[model samples]
Target: METPTAPGPDVPRRSLISGSAAMAAAGGLVLGAGAATAAAAAMAPNGASGVVQGARNGDERHPFYGEHQAGISTPPQDHLVFTAFDVTATTPVELQLVLAKWSAAMAELTNGRPVGKVQPARANGVPGDTGEAADMGPHGLTLTLGFGPSLFDGRFGLEKFKPAGFDQLPAMAGESLDPAMTGGDLCIQACANDPQVAYHAVRNLARMARTSVRTRWTVLGFGRASAGANQITPRNLLGFKDGTRNIKTEEDFAEHVWVGDEAGQGWMAGGSYLVARKIHMMIETWDEDPINDQQGIFGRTKQAGAPLSGTREHDVPDFHAAAPGGGPVIPADSHIALAAHENNGGTKILRRGYNFTDGLDAVGRLDAGLMFLSFQRDPEQFVALQRKLGSSDRLNEYIRHVGSGVYAVPGGLPAAGNYYGKEFFPG
Candidate 1:
């Protein structure tokens, strides 16, 4: 195992949670909570959206092939805690095709009726789709299914999660007309159906998405490896970068995602758990701003990653240091201000976001942003943070929420027989 090395003065932690720290961390506890919000990048001069989507993996594609932080090792072979596909579309039939091969299919969002108090898939008591129902294949399939720990978690025996799987596939970048555009029916934005992937298993679905004729919404999903030959380290679209500002895995479920607690019921557990929002960035707008203005909004420098009115990116803002009597130096409305409680541990969520950039725009537009997707324990925790940002924050001015929806991320699968969200939310 390699030793952890905290990156130099500018980089984040590069070491291990040795001794008590490691023990506490292993058991699911975080000490100090530092935050790193987006800082404005220097305007691209010519006014181009600097954002760019990562291309298909050109190197080896497998769970075991990639390298991760030292000491934090995977099995002799690589695996995932789970794999999921959030495909989008209209026409119940179109969505049906994707689920045709699966053991069960659940229409999660049909014209706006949230899967009411989700129960076991069997409770719907609709006859199985195997024999008499097998004909449903004619209609396409819609899915929010996934591969869980049983299918991805490396440590299944003692952990609260288990089951993992492996497969690779194709995908692309594109969309279709949704009622959301004309307000006819709901438009689908499947991250599972986007144009980013390393290998080929899920590509089959992407190909299907592009070809499907009946759907109103287009697909914008990406297939990640649940198991097998595909690699993804904890980094943003930037190759050498790792989103260290994020919470740990254990903290992921317990904090952000829904788990049986005094607040909610058990069915919500292994069921959420919850889906975060789809925050889109107006890359063009962001790319056109001056660095000084950018720094003002984020309170940080792009290169040094330091706060405008402060020291380093992780340095606690000396909110009171400057004026014995303070007045908006850090801008109470800034993104940093709203996300401030994250430092106090008041409310935290596991942010597993992705960076995507579509090509260029006609009038030099930039269609790219970080897919601000996160899993949460409750929608309110996230909303509260947003409430702080209010409806009109500096960040919001440059970002547009083109798509929005939620899903109950499923549990782990034991084998290939049939796995997805169906098993997690038992009827």
Candidate 2:
């Protein structure tokens, strides 16, 4: 994949990296790259200094710094380790320090290097970097940070920095939200081809910030449930192709996914809002249903994944096509009919969800589900469609909404010495 360039000239590079990492540079926690005149080398980690080069398998890597954060619009990876964190610091500076440390560590990790100075094996001294992913190439790993709604609840003096439309999602129908898994002050989304690579990124990050933050909840997912640019659609636990109409083209991203200056907060201009839902599927029950009923639930053929009115997967659904007898060909309550952008005022969301399975739930039936994740310019795009799904979608009978979160993902760092969310804490 080509390295994504910096955002259009409207967003200044300095403004993107002016805060936490710069603060660390002043205090000596970080090293300086070349002077301003040095040409940009291969992209560094989001907040770390200097170009990171190394040997690897296929050198499958994604640049950490770009116009928008990696892992959002980037093609979906094979595995995911999504984690939310709660800040325990009492002051803004304390929280800033935590973000700074994480930023520097991310730079190294994404560049296929270890965090901090790598030291030789010592008999008594502990190592500064965790050695789990030592030899692993970048593995196409991407770590994207997000600030949850709680982070702006008058904490860290960030209330004024919250986007105008940003807020916790309201309780929609069919939701039995678990308090422990619902809200968080921050979140980090790690996606990579290797499960270990994704896990190592989160494990090391949590270890580094243990003093200032605690993991609120985590989910490990495999077999991406959605497709991105040039990717083929993958199936969800429900045995149906998911995200068949996801936002893909640059035009679609600008229209539906990436946030623009209308965000009412300049810092969030290139950033997007994220919504995650833990949807537990009743696999046993779903498997018992007749194939025709299953097809009706999703409005797509089980084997071919084509719309009810079409013969192929990508064929536009003829929502208005008449059935042989009298009714509409596609049921109004089917998942696709209700969630389709055409039916919802042309609204679209970029989906990067994954299929997940835990051992089992309370009763002994398999505990597996879709970790429903989507990014949009505004959260309401999801809310409006979900409200429709939550209330009337036929598929609701086979799933339960147990956990949820909404976060404001800031724009990407422009270069080294820039931490995520730097624009939020301007001097």
Candidate 3:
């Protein structure tokens, strides 16, 4: 299928309001109390919208437009409702329209407003907004979009526009993938502090794209954030502090996360590659293990999240250090030992994974684990780490990698235009 090429100027390039401005405008409209109100005010400038702005609060309300996408590095939200879609549009124009609509809806949703203004009298037709999140604040919602390698097929004449590193991932060892959960033509990762907010974002976008896309697979996840004033680490379902040593800071992000301009596919510059995996944890088996055994597998103290070689969580692991009796303090086969940057040619990826629970399986065993999401400058970084982890990580015995995908996330929407992936469709 093909679309008649329209004149360049005819395509919609911008939404009604830019993402940042929308947030600023909505900031004054007080949502609720506590973090929600503080977050909203922080997003807007003082007196910008006649609302009394507070000192910057928690990591909420990331701008939708920038050099790089927000969700990848923006503090990981507490909940996630990630969905992958198969583009069913027969024409490029139809696909572009879907993106335009998605961008407009996303702008409003991220600003703590309903997709459409409420008008009871004119609401005779299909509801313009789903209304699930009508009263809830934005909750630091971030909607990140990406294109899978399948999107570059001949369907939209995008074969030649495929980014260099945007290839389907090669199969790794120990993968028992379910076909339904494996791949998709495109993906959107909706993350928010509140689960309902996240779900609402994805649901509305999928609804809007009903004509141009079909849902391939979706995963809902929640995370347990650390308690206390300085909440730095979040625990996974495995009861281990995940992403403790993850790449943070602007310098690290530039070095390890954002794709460089010279890295082939100009459209992908400032963007990053996402590697998603659905790992099923063998809960019954893991639960039977002793505390020491569990700690040994992860190479970290369960209570303090400290490396086996050190007493503090932030202390750099001395991989070469020996225990009192002998042997390495951090076990050779432990998850951290093999997956660490030191072991992988100094490579690192930004982890934004979330713990998930999906009730029980047919056998009545608890079906819960992680939706592993990692972003890197290159897909090779994740591929290399996974290859090592699959072979020797001790935690492998208790986890099974059942679903996977790789996507090339393009740079953020330009300040003037709210459209996404517009560069891929340039005439």
Error of 1 at 1 (Å): 13
Q: Which tens-of-lDDT digit does each residue in 1-427 have in candidate 2?
A: 3332222221122222233234433553322222111212222334323232222352467777777888898888889999999998676655766675576567657766665323534566455456788777667788989999899989788888877768899999978899888979999999988888889889888876675689999989987999987778999998898878888899999988898999788768788998999888989999999999999888899999999999999999999999999887888899999999889999889989999988887888898899999999999999999999999999999999988999998887777666665555543
Query: Which lDDT tens digits does candidate 3 get at residues 1-427?
Result: 1111221111121122123224323433222223222222222221112121122332246566677777887777788988899998777756665665566566556666665433334556445467888766667788999889999988988888787656889888867899899889989999888899899889877876676699999999988332212347988877888777887778888999898875567778889989889999998899899999999999999989999999999899989999889999999999989988898789988888888888999989999999999999999999998888888889999999988999988887655344665655543
- Model 2: residues >4 Å from true position, as ranges? 1-58, 117-121
- Candidate 1 per-residue lDDT, tens place, 34-147, comes to 100000011011111112112322211111101111001111111111123333333232322233222111211100111111122456542111122111111111223322
Q: Estimate each model's TM-score.
A: 0.48, 0.87, 0.85
C-alpha RMSD by candidate, in order:
20.3, 6.4, 10.2
Clashes (N, CA, C under 3 Å) per candidate: 59, 1, 0
Q: Tell me model 1's lDDT, rounded to 2 decimals.
A: 0.32
Best by TM-score: 2
State residue 420's C-alpha deviation in candidate 1, in Å. 2.8
Q: Rank candidates, lDDT, best first.
A: 2, 3, 1
Residue 384 displacement (Å), model 1: 2.6
